[model samples]
Target: MKQKKPNILFIMTDQLRGDCLGIAGHPDVKTPYLDTLAAKGVLFSNAYSACPSCIPARAALHTGMLPEHHRRVGYQDGIAWRYEHTLAGELSRAGYYTQCVGKMHVHPLRNYLGFHNVELHDGYLHYARYGSVPYRESQHVADDYYYWLKEQKGISADPMESGLDCNSWVARPFPYEEKYHPTNWVTDRSIDFLRRRDPDQPFFLMASYLRPHPPFDAPAYYFDLYKDKKLTPPYVGDWEDTKLLKERGRIFDSLTGPEDEELIRQAQIGYYACITHLDHQIGRLLMALTEHELQNDTMIFFTADHGEELCDHHHFRKSLPYQGSIHIPLIISGNPELTGFAPHSVCDEVTELCDIMPTLLDIAGADIPDRVDGKSLLAFADGEGREYLHGEHSYGELSNHYIVTKKDKFCWFSTSGTEHYFVLEEDPHELHDRIEDPACRERIAYLRNCLIRELTGRPEGFTDGTSLIAGREYPVYLAEK
Candidate 1:
């Protein structure tokens, strides 16, 4: 008999910081399911997102390319990987039934990139006129947290009224409805899909969860989970200190002033709750798999698009290159035969979002394109992951870039000409800035110069290639407009 191909369950959560998981050594949060998952599978201890935002980060995961190559660029802009062959497309070609349920974050909200079977349950908050195109058109019909404020909560507070004080885009809450809460609804749909899936041929199912992201709202019960847990976070940094930062670092300053601590604590609480909620859903999905007897043959991989700030360094959201935002959990469970080399192993090697595609393809016995920027770690099952991981974010008016090596980190501000250097071994929180420290000037120079060369060498003015189709597809909506 021929060797059986393994099915893959790729689970992703939005804005879940690295320390949020119990397996990741988080002190407060309760993540029994994830902890159990990590115990059975290999956990990439230092897996980081290539970019800190949604579209670009997710784009990298699906396409096996970098943001510089994909050209999806920012939040508002969407990169069309319509032309490249995605992991889904590759698996589909290899006779696997690829299905995507819940937030894929594909642009136009209608264009199906590669997965022939797709159901867009929810996605990031879209503020444009295209808002009408999301799962819910008006906030009236759906009650996201924002909606809860306007209706159920009867809170008429705007960003300023709510004591957000700053002009930050993330200050204000949005409408919310428990009925459409993406996490719950998404899992509900996924369970339905798994229940109805035919078990004959191998299947590739990605049940992406959009939680622990923002609006920090879940069912009231979830919020109550962390009510008693003391809000203990990593060392909080001085926001007013931005010597190397080019701009005012509006986000940094946003963490100061009254109500800041409370707001941040609440956000943390909500974020933790969101995480636990997702874990419960994971348990459900795994149970369904077990019930269907798909657990043995399926290769389950759990990760996230990027991590949330969760008040880390006084930052409320992603878009920063800090370890808090970039580092995410990567757990691969089941398929004990394949896990032999890395069974229950915790690899601290640096890996990027781009590596996910090639890894999936290699395991599925599909052809991985040579143009992919990420290397497959399947080879490292017995070896080790890379020593460095790169991440960048050029969204909004700020241009922040980072390169993380085994021992050192180099950060650059495009507008300020200011550079940041931190020896990761000594300064884990990245609180101490050694940009001007002469002792490590050579190391900084070496890393900065290397990163500059990499950034400059990217195919400027064009997005990276995807595995979906043959050529690259540029942004048609905003670029044309």
Candidate 2:
């Protein structure tokens, strides 16, 4: 008999940083559930987002192509990009039940962007105020919690705010709610799908969670978990001095001040608290999986769309390619017999978000298409090596590009027209910018050339490698096909 094709359960979070989880060696943040998941699976220590914002990142994940190639470069209007292919399309083609619950972020077609069915709950909110859809009104955010919040006295709240109560940790506007929380809804639906699913046929379920993003708010109890505990904020370098600063007119800047370390500290606390809240929900999902005896047959992956600034570099939002804005956690959990093939392994190689599609295809015994610009992690997890990885962020707020190897990293700000170079092993915090270093200039040029190549989809020695972000237009490679 042929080997059984594993069910694919991709649990993707939004705006979660790489260091937010305990499995990533964070000293403070509590992520016991994720740590447990990591123990049973492979952890990619150097996993980077393909694009640092929501829409572009989601596009990359679905298409297995870079942001520029897939088009949906920014969260603007309709489905602007003519996608080559998507994992959902592939899995559906292979006769798998491809289902997407929660945010898939594809525009034009609201239902089933290649998936057989999609329970879309607040995906790519292009119309609502502050990028928020009416989570409560849509029956996506949880009605009981909204009622409870409205009934609470001495809290001083707004009904509009009550409607906005989706779970997230990044400091902003609302608090986490379990009833209508995106994580809870997505997980609940996933569990339901699993229970009702045809056991004979394999399933491909993408459970997307919208939390640990912004408007950092969770249940007051989760806040209490870190209320007394001190949370460390990201190091604030000479933010004003560096051109690498966030694009001018960024929103979160008004919330911070020169001597507002305590304020920043509170913000960090709120952020981590939100992450912990999401982790708790993840624990619930995992428990359900085990209770249903679905853990072994399911190849589960936990990762995020992108990282939030969380007051890093004096910026609070995402859409930048800095480590704080691009690096994210990637944990793959599944059968111990298969995981034992490389037990408790860590792959430090640079891998892009696009790589996820190929990996999933490999796991499902499907052939990977040629247009996808990523590689499978089969070798990397088994202690093999990979070359450089790249990420893109063309959101209006931040124009950024990045490429990384295990040792060196180069980040560019297309909005500011500045380049940053850092040796990761030497200065992990990226405190020192080596772009101007005499010995590093040659390497910087090489990396910049590579960025142009990757972004333009041209070969290395192409002198006419144009840049849309930098105002030089050769043949504008439109994001759409």
Ten residues in sequence with the least summed lDDT for candidate 2: 249-258
Give a tens-digit lDDT track for model 1, residues 397-443.
34566889767788765444456787877977777878878998888
RMSD of 2: 5.1
How high is the lDDT of residue 116 in model 2? 84
- Score every model by TM-score: 0.82, 0.83
Candidate 2 stretches with Cα past 4 Å from truth are: 1-3, 80-84, 123-177, 238-259, 336-341, 382-386, 395-398, 455-469, 473-481
lDDT of 1: 0.67
lDDT of 2: 0.68
Number of colliding residue pairs in model 2 = 11
| lDDT, each prediction | 0.67, 0.68
Output the number of the TM-score-best candidate. 2
Q: What stretches of model 1 exceed 4 Å from their correct place?
A: 1-3, 127-180, 238-259, 458-481
